[model samples]
Target: METLTNLESFVRSAESGSFSAAARRLALTPAAVSRNVAMLERNLGVRLFQRSTRKLTLTEAGESFLAAVGGNLESLQNAIAAVSADDGQPAGVLKISVAPSFGIGYLLPLLPEFLQRYPRVRPEWHFENRTVDLIAEGYDAAIGGGFELASGVVARTLAPLHVIAFASPAYLARHTLPADPSGLIDLDCIVMRSLSSGRIRTWNMRNAQGDEVIATMRETVVVNDPTAVREAARLGLGVAMLAVPDVLPELESGELVRVLPRWWADAGALSLYYPSRQLMPGKTRSFIDFVVEAFQREDYARRFAGSLG
Candidate 1:
């Protein structure tokens, strides 16, 4: 019989393509993972991987074995995790990925209360702007909008992602406030360049009555980040279009005011993403419930809606 650790090491090594990566995911040393795989090979009487200085490649035997066991590993792990949590307390490392601005501004505030409730769960948070593969990257959950739903992943929407035009009061003081998108042609416009695509982003804005208009503007400043766009607008550079959640604080504080307030573009829904598994880790389940409850209690869905503007 093969040990679960040996099977897990072989599977993770096969999936990640390197012992070091597998070690990181498994929270083991590279030597330990290598030894586990070696042990598994010794037990099975066949080499699973072709070793190399640059990359780890699976052998024909390894490929077949992976195909046989890959699908069942997750279920076995989840079952073990559920059983290990005998006290029904959510305890362990809760790994999460989130966008920097949104995570720092909103989610960070909830940490104190969350930690108080789940004292045994340690949070490992990665704040980055790109969409992460939740299962591949070993994240328990992720928070953001516009992520593609990959296999074995699911999304729970928290709020509407509405892009609306905004500028500092100082900037609007010097220029005419656009009555609509067309009036933005003569104004200096701060635009967002897509970080993934390397192209300037433009949206088609709509009103409550379903009136649509293209938000075509002169791109005076092109920034690749939401924070930069907000800051540029705050520095009175030009008008910027941003998601309501991104600039909610600025809007509430009068640091930035909405321009063409009646119009906004529906980008998508801000979502909580996680793996779609039959049995979830207790910590992941608890964190998801906490965030969803917080969002509901605070009425963020309505507050983050630009249509209400």
Candidate 2:
């Protein structure tokens, strides 16, 4: 008979996406997790993962195994939790999804502190701009900023960020700043295609007085990463809309200058979202608390209204 420990470790490795992360969650050595997985593979007589330096992707066998056993293990863990709520500290793998740009700019830097504080809580962070399927993909929680969400999930606000339009000082020095967004059509625009929307975004800028300008960007330098877009804008490529947190350093240093002082775009708020559950797991609750406390710090999310190109 297969041991529950073996099944537990296998499921954790699959959810965490690597042996090292799984081991961290289990408070075991990476080699130990590797051994557990290896033993299971040997017993089953098939390969489970196709691993590489770049990524750890699941094989068909691994996917099938995860699908078959993940929910059962989750149920078992939950039942144990309900019976022994106060018996122990929270422990388990926390799989979180975040956008690549925001993770790079803000969240990733704070992770070390979180790990140091919660020794029993191991986090497997996935930085991808793609939409997260909480149930299907086995993610415990997701940190995202968008106006919309899929059906049946619960979203909680993390922070509200304003949309600012900006461009580099170098670009403005060579090319006159567009006094109004209507002039943006004549200037270079850095186009970012949304992973979720599957369409190019051209936002309308509106002033506090209710005046509006629809900035239709026809000729744009394109990039997928928001960091790349910010870099391009910093290097004088074009004007771009960005979250205030991402461009704060530039704004403070005067490296990037805002356009159209009075008008601001309606950028959506940032949030942490997950699939609704009748019983939130201890791991999930701890993860949410850590994130909420981090971003709720007043200085962490403060941003001004202006042009960010």
Q: Which candidate is the best by lDDT?
A: 1
lDDT of 2 by residue, 175-239 (tens): 87677788878888887887667678777878877788887765578876678878989888888
TM-score of each: 0.91, 0.71
Positional deviation of residue 181's Cα in model 2 after best superposition, in angstroms: 1.2
lDDT of 2 at 207: 80
lDDT of each: 0.91, 0.75
- Stretches off by above 4 angstroms in model 2 are 1-75, 82-88, 147-152, 196-198, 304-309
Please estimate how well model 2 matches the true structure, expressed as its whole-model Cα lDDT. 0.75
Provide the global lDDT of candidate 1 against the true structure: 0.91
**Candidate 1 Cα outliers beyond 4 Å, as residue runs:** 1-3, 20-32, 39-46, 59-72, 84-86
How many backbone clashes does every candidate have?
Answer: 0, 8
Please give me the total number of clashing residue pairs in predicted model 1. Answer: 0
Clashing pairs in 2: 164-308, 165-307, 165-308, 166-307, 166-308, 166-309, 239-309, 240-309
